[model samples]
Target: MSQNREMKLAAYLVGTGIHVASWRHPSAKPNTSIDIEALQHLAQTAERGKFDLAFIADSLAINPESHPQILNRFDPVVLITALSAVTRKIGVGATASTTYSEPYILARQFASVDHISGGRAAWNVVTTADATGETALNFSRDKHWEHDHRYERAEEFIDVVQGLWDSWEDDAFTYNKQTGQFFNPDKLHELNFKGKYFSVKGPLNIARSKQGQPVIIQAGASLPGQRLAARTAEVVFVHWDNIKEAKHHYKKLKSQLKDFGRNEDELHILHGISPIIGETEEAAIQKYNDLQNLIDPYEALKFVSGYMGNVDFSKYSLDTPAREIEFPHVNSIQSNFNEMKKIVEKEDLKVGDLYTRFFGAARRDGFIGTPVQIADELEKWFTEKAADGFMIQFPLLPNDLEDFVRLVIPILQERKLFRLDYEGNTLREHLNLKKPKNVFIQKTGASKSYSKI
Candidate 1:
């Protein structure tokens, strides 16, 4: 496979790190979940490596039954907005749910971050789907919308957010002290959007950003989720752990672009990988084992059980042989349930295996050797079209993150598989993605509409 494109990399920093037991790892920094400085350092490390983005993910409510590491999290947007102050080049991605958030407010918040970061902002759009996750929050819904309806709402939700983003043109803000013309009214565009899920008034108060609007990132595996990602997501995150599955998903999503009149290049498909790096193969294996050993199997089971359609796996004997059984329709995340079913059926994994087999962040076969070996695997994935790049979730912070930048990134740079320096300041530019045209301005091709509002 030819490797012409430089692979894009984003730091997926969640919890203390991606691993369930990451915070408790001896090398793990304390209070990373709430520690502003810790998060900032991680972002800076990614920037030092010239990574494309730093993505923070969140679910609406804490799964009280979750492992201790995951129970506490800073709000993603607030955290990224803070990180934007410390890092200059890397994009800040904050996850917000379409199901629970008010579109207008969500739009303003992300737009604010975009301005704060000088256009290095991305919104990782998600629908809240934890069993009792929504109810546990402030919502009073006894029965949450089914998977299809949530996607339906999400589709409309994104449309409204994007529409709200178009409320101003790039040239709208003009402080003409000489003429006393405070602004170009003609350049301000109002988004009079009325949709099933939202009714946003004309024009967001924020001016057009360097990227025109915040980049949209989506992770959807369900049919509807896939469709939504194809239509609107600038970057699509996938849970694919194998090359063959990654290739299949990558091809399927790219295939959907033409239907939306979008170029395949317009959507970057990134597979999530948690890299456990070491100076040597032996060191890397030892580090990975140490991380996994930190996890309490019972706590891990509870964590996956919540996500696996709220099934009480603890009730089943630890050694209960996993079998192919049709799970009932789960409102939480049908796609995850489906994925787990396939894994169990294929591997014949048992309840006992959920700890490392399913819940652990460190994938043994992933970029798990010396820096050069890690780069080799990444290059193969990039060239093979298994991924446009990787959403890299480090196994531990400061140490693990520091090692990747210090070691693996240079190998990728030496091989010309990754960039050593950022050519453009904006996140979209860093990713070689086009800044989106304002929908309202695209239609009129003139600034007259700004004043007409």
Candidate 2:
């Protein structure tokens, strides 16, 4: 811990909390997502602890009948923007789909928030994997692009958005009262980009930021997804069942940076960890077990089944051993498919066992332990290069969140594994990432040619 890099952490504010049944907990508010004050409180708590960022995840489509959490919530970008008006230092970000959104609109949405936040903004680029949800929105249901094509579109979409963000140079604006000129025409570079999926012309309607660009975050594990992260993402949210697996994913993602001419340090890999911190080691394990018991078996089954490519477990007998069966294609999320397949082959888990096993990984990962014990585990991961830091997911809202900040945070700071105080004004500086130069300014090798002082 004493020899480690400063931790870059983000709090994932998912609904009331990360625990599937956190809302039902006595300490949690079931409807906090809809309550602006609750949301603001969560952001404020993280910022108070000097966290690098606070994250809000989103889904464009809904299936309220099954997954109740995401059925209703403010758009991540909009919510973060609102929060930015209140919080001063911590970076804020939200997941926005590149598959379903036009590049221009998406670019504008994040850019506006970044400007308003004084450059503490992040845009988590994602491709919508919910085909049925798209159908509900009147988008081509049957005509949804397959997995590979979606990634391809995401790559292009991200490229176009970055191009638009570079439309104006850092010093392009010159609002001199004596002079009539509003901006340097030569500094306003037009994108004039034409691609297979889009044709966007010229510079964006907004100017650049102090950080030069908003921080880019991507959560992709597929082949194309990995490449996109390597090429552009400053941070990536990764999932792993073990340190060994985390190490492999971390190494593979970092190795790809060379192909894109990117430095390895440019991308920070934060593995998803939902920690259940208790006053004592014994109590922490019980807290985890209590949450598991509180979860409705039916609801847990429904969520994991959808997560596993919409394979129906409704017809299967609870006692029947889960078998390894391969479908020709999976239209849903694919992160844990291979892991589940391995479990079916090696463990021969029952129908009920399958859901419980999947739910544990999906809902809470890393490990359940006391503040001291959890800190030890995280230090192991960080020192071994398994992760740069963790994307924290507290099982319960204010109660659990407070415990982590109050207990775990002090230990990390004491060991020099985390920041003692905020060292920078903007998120980029907080993370120690270099502010990017506008493309036009970087390539031209020209100094600013101001018409008047």
| Highest-lDDT candidate | 1
Clashing pairs in 2: none
lDDT of 1 by residue, 1-453 (tens): 444588989898865777778878877665778888877888998899899999998876665566565567788999999999998889999899888888889999999999999999999998877765545346766566677888998888888888778787777778899999978877776766666766667678888788888999998888998899888989998876479988998998899999889997898888888788877889999998898888777777777777676667767777887673334557776666777777877887778786677643545876788888888899889998999998987877777778889998888898888887999999999888898877766455854332211
RMSD of 1: 2.5
- Model 2 Cα lDDT, one tens digit per residue, 305-392: 6556566666666776777444335654556566666667787677777655665323344467788888898888998999999898
Model 1 misses residue 401 by how many Å?
1.1
* Candidate with maximal TM-score: 1
Candidate 2 vs. true structure, TM-score: 0.94
Per-residue error for 375 in candidate 2, Å, reads 0.3
Error of 2 at 256 (Å): 1.0
